[model samples]
Target chain A: MLTLAQAQTIMTTALAHAQSAGFKPLTIAILDARGAQKLFTAQDGTSLKRGEIAIGKAHGAVAMGIGSRALHKMALERPYFVEAATHAVGGSLVPVPGGVLIRDAAGTLLGAIGVSGDTSDNDEAAALAGITAAGLVGDTGA
Target chain B: MLTLAQAQTIMTTALAHAQSAGFKPLTIAILDARGAQKLFTAQDGTSLKRGEIAIGKAHGAVAMGIGSRALHKMALERPYFVEAATHAVGGSLVPVPGGVLIRDAAGTLLGAIGVSGDTSDNDEAAALAGITAAGLVGDTGA
Candidate 1:
């Protein structure tokens, strides 16, 4: 079962990765299975919008049970899915940087992590770090 | 002479402050004299809503020639101004957190910064950091 402690651990790890990478300040968010925020943190000098984006990305991942990057690929194959999903979510389901799926050792869905700032690759890396630090697995499939 | 470089610098600094303060992940944007984006960055994990909010705040600040916080206050006295400005900007002028005027050392208007995440106070502080880091001034009316 996913726990708040795990979420917090992921967020902390992501923040540290961002600082160490020498990227700009970052925003990290973790969402529970219900798509609610379990942990959210924005570094000093991070933009205000980072929080929203992080939440949106994580929400999308949790709601769909897939990593946002994979969703982006699916969007390309099924534009209708993308359109319908976006409309259904009231524009909160953004398939962009800073979204990752969290799973257990057995690949059971647990939650998700979203990160923003820097490049999309950098965001993915940070999210992965958070997941691993939390003793969870991250889905990076395309 | 105002330049995009200065605006970007301000935005970068503001984001850094936001992260250090433990605020939510955020999106930040800067607009030039013509109301064009000078710089835009969404920290790792920020949401799409933050982008909209940041842009709105920045637009409001530039259009009204006042900080967004002051605009929020003036909204009470001149609801019409707030309403009209909001409409004039195509519903992009949000009079809330993460927006401020950018002025030079001599108090000359250069541009504006908009931030979103956490609370309004935290947003404003981040924006102020950006302004000061850019060697510019911010009018928070505090």
Candidate 2:
């Protein structure tokens, strides 16, 4: 189970990384293994839809049981499959790099983190950094 | 515009109310007036869909520009209209009393709060108490 404190720690470290890296304002979402949101935050200047986008990334990762980087590749290789998958996930799937799965040292899935409001790579980097800070493995499907 | 600090304050106070009243575990959602989520939390042990339900309540109220208590009445009086309106809101409307609109003392709409996992009246009461603690007016359409 992902404790709320762990989720809060992940977000705090992620935002700190974003700040130090000089990324744009960000919106971040954390979801437990069941795909239920645990914590969410949108920076003051984030665009209106950024929060949904961030949640979509995290939700998609958890729903598909894969990191969103793989989903992005699938989207390119087979658009039709991604389209159907999107519907199956209730329209909350954003196939992109920023959605990463969190796993334990034993490869047990803990949850996911999604970040938005910067380049997809930068977003993913921030997420990975946060997961590392929490002493968890971040699987970006690389 | 609703500040994140205010949103945090609202959630903190609302949860305090729920705990004091011995309500069931809750999922709470807060949205800015533009219908974007600002903050969300699902207490431990909340059912799988409680978070979505909480978001639906707040999103529906903001979408319809009225508190969800009013939407519940509209649902009873004009079921078809309510049905259509639900579709218009992208299937996130929960026409129930737990969704309350937040407004300044001057009646300017700021945002909304939604709480789920207890009796609707109790949920609305907690939301109202939170808004009051934040020094904002909570319009439950009563």
Candidate 3:
């Protein structure tokens, strides 16, 4: 089981990366297998909107069982499904930046991480660092 | 400016109280003034279903500038406005347990918290813990 400590480490590392990269402050979230929040953080200067975007990305990854990039592509191909999910989930299905699937070395689905700060690419990179630092594998979908 | 630390601490204390009270596992969310995420947590056994409820409550509190309990009452008295907000926010309006406004000592708007667990009352109690822990005032709608 992924402990809250591990999730916090990922969030901390991700935020550190964002700071080192000179990106805007960010918000990060990690969710466990059952879509429960394990850890979440928002940096000092991060816009309030970034927090929701981060959660949406993380929530989207956990709900769809895939990295947000894949979900994003899926949304492009099947806008209707995305729309339906949006209505069904009631605003938790955000298919945007800073979300990725987290897995163990043996390929078990553990959870997900999301980050929001600079551009989507930068945010993705920061999230990937956190996953790697925590010794977790992330499905980047690219 | 509500720091993330304050938000997380509030949520942590709230969850602890909920667990001590033997309530069901929960999904809880907090949002700052700009409607961005401040903190989010899902207890060990909380189902994904709770996520929607929690988010809806938080969103409703922010959108209506009132506690969700008040919104629930208003919904009964003015169904049209509630229904319209439900549609306007892309289906994120929830006027039930687990939502409340966060205010400063002077009653300035700071943020909102939403929770989903046991009953609306239980959820409200948890939200109250979070708000109080953060040194923010809250109206439980009771």
In TM-score terms, which candidate is top? 2
- Estimate, for each residue in B1-142, the C-alpha lDDT of model 2 and write its tens digit: 8887788889889999999999999889999989888888888888878899999899999998899999999999999998999998799999989999999899999999999999999999999998999999999977
What fraction of the genuine interface contacts, i.e. the true contacts, does candidate 2 reproduce?
A: 0.69
Chain A (alone) TM-scores for all candidate structures: 0.90, 0.98, 0.92
* Residue A15 alpha-carbon offset, candidate 1, angstroms: 1.4
Sorted on lDDT, highest at the top, how do the candidates line up? 2, 3, 1
The lDDT values for all models are 0.75, 0.92, 0.81
Off by over 4 Å in 2: A76-84
* CAPRI-style class, candidate 3: acceptable
DockQ values for all predictions? Answer: 0.04, 0.67, 0.40
lDDT of 1 by residue, A44-77 (tens): 6553344655676777788777788876676557
* TM-score of the B chain in each candidate versus the native B chain: 0.90, 0.98, 0.93
Give candidate 3's error at residue B52 in angstroms. Answer: 1.5
Leading candidate by DockQ? 2
True contacts kept of 3: 0.64
